[model samples]
Target: MSTSVLQWNLFLLVSSRKEFFYMDIELPASLKLTLSIVNSIPIIISMFGFLGNGKVIHLLGFHIEKNPFTTCTLNLSIADFGVFTSFLHTIGYIDQVDTIVYIYLLVTYFFLFMYNTGQYLLTAISMERCVSVIFPLWHRCHRPPHFSTLVCATIWITSFLLTVICIIIVIFRVTTKPLFYLLLMNAILCLPLMTVSTLVLFIKVCFRSQQRNKGKALTAILLALLFFLFLAFPFTFYVSYCYYFPHLHSLMLIGFGCSSVNSSINPIIYFLVGRRGRKSPSRVSMRAAISRVFKDVGDCTEDKKSRTESKVMI
Candidate 1:
């Protein structure tokens, strides 16, 4: 779950080729100590991330105004929290004890589901913002009030079904091929969609638009997307590649470390973006900062303003 389930399956498959099992693979004492130290770093970092995400969830869900973007962010924080919680399982430690392995597998299923749901929700957030910018009139006049909530619910359901199907495939057929393709499909579909949507927002809103304010909201979204693409994507690509070259198993810790950083960085991004122009960072409360990020005119007000400005110019 924290790592790919496919990675575990491939590890089992690799035992057929070489002595890859933890009990079988012999390492020097120094290397084992180094790996153990490196592994602990993520756990410490993830604890901070878990706390930060919890704070974000509390503020966004309870304190901020209810808008589509805030709704998306609240869910995003929950997903990140789940990621850190599930990462607590020591899947890397292969014990002869069956109880530990069973626990790891159980946690893995939920991890995959949450990770996939987060990816889809992020894509939806970016795409929705881009559309509102590109087609302002349509966005104001025709968009449903609860559209974001509906999309998020749909994403959760779809992710659950897909993860269940993957588990079923492994249980019955004992192959990793289905899960591998599923990961490949997610990377192929969601990443490009996010990239394109984010790019459009930058070009239209940041580079060329005539809005009086770019606002902390858009700034927060842009920063978050940038961090995810740079920090988390290494792990995403690594899992896809590791299936073929299981010899690169040594780098798995590094990959997970990158992901943990990505998972934990969003709250910091929001705070910094929201703290802009303030005389002192400590003076700005978290609730005030987050509210500034989610502040935007209502659909009707924005549409009316647009029409009035157009008539005056003409």
Candidate 2:
């Protein structure tokens, strides 16, 4: 079955003529390599951060804390990492014309879909934050950590199911019309949600005096949303064109390249304008308090052991 799938993917790659290798305008190989390396930076940083701090934080039971922002950001980083890795594989196979290359392309398609879904999830997170800030009372009643987790889980599961459905549809139908429809549906559904979330975030930032310093935060979200929109819009249009006019294969290839840029931009935005770089003294103090609590627990445990030994000796 795996070999059959691989063969089918390779057939798709060869027959479609829209693989990433062939471009209309000549781009220097060195420039392409440079761009690919630059784009991979965000994925690298986010993967490391997500793997490093994310696990430690979760192990410390901090995942259940009242910080929806942190939890959502962590999940976003993981999703970004997934998107990045997938795109990196695609980039690596840009010149290859083999079954393995097609497999990488197939994986890239899956991750592109995943990346779109992740954008929606991130927008949902922003909406949750907006509600919490703008409607604090209602947010308290409705948007607790458990509620957020449930929503996040639902987004993930729904995305996975949807991706599976898309793959099944593609495999069975094998027609361009369905692909166009699928891409259009995804774009129409996601773009508006992202736009609204970005707007709400902006409004929330503007209204809240305390959050005025969060201009950078608002900008980051806006930039990320714009990045997504820019990448997705062209891909959607290219897919539509491919359905109607298959000769425009080079356009499709370029669109994929542009879309690859989206996966690499989120972590850079976060690092530059998001929470990681903006850690205030209050956050440091909170970390210190947590460390102290752990130390106190250890000291109590040691004291209990010592007392038990003394009692036994007596």
- Steric clash pairs (candidate 2): none
Tens-place lDDT digits, model 2, residues 109-209: 66655666676676776666556556755655444435657777787887777666766655555553444566677778766777787677766655767
Top candidate when judged by TM-score against the true structure: 1
TM-score of each: 0.83, 0.62
What are the Cα lDDT values of the candidates? Answer: 0.71, 0.55
| Tens-digit lDDT track of model 1 for 1-314 | 22333335543454243333233334466755665565566678878998899999998877766777888888888888888877765535632223344455556667677777777888888888878778977887677868889988898889989988887776665565665677788889988988988798677657754543445667777778777778766666777777687667645556666777888998988887777767887899877777666775333345566876898999
Deviation in angstroms for 290 in model 1? 0.8
Error of 2 at 69 (Å): 2.0
TM-score for candidate 2, please give it: 0.62
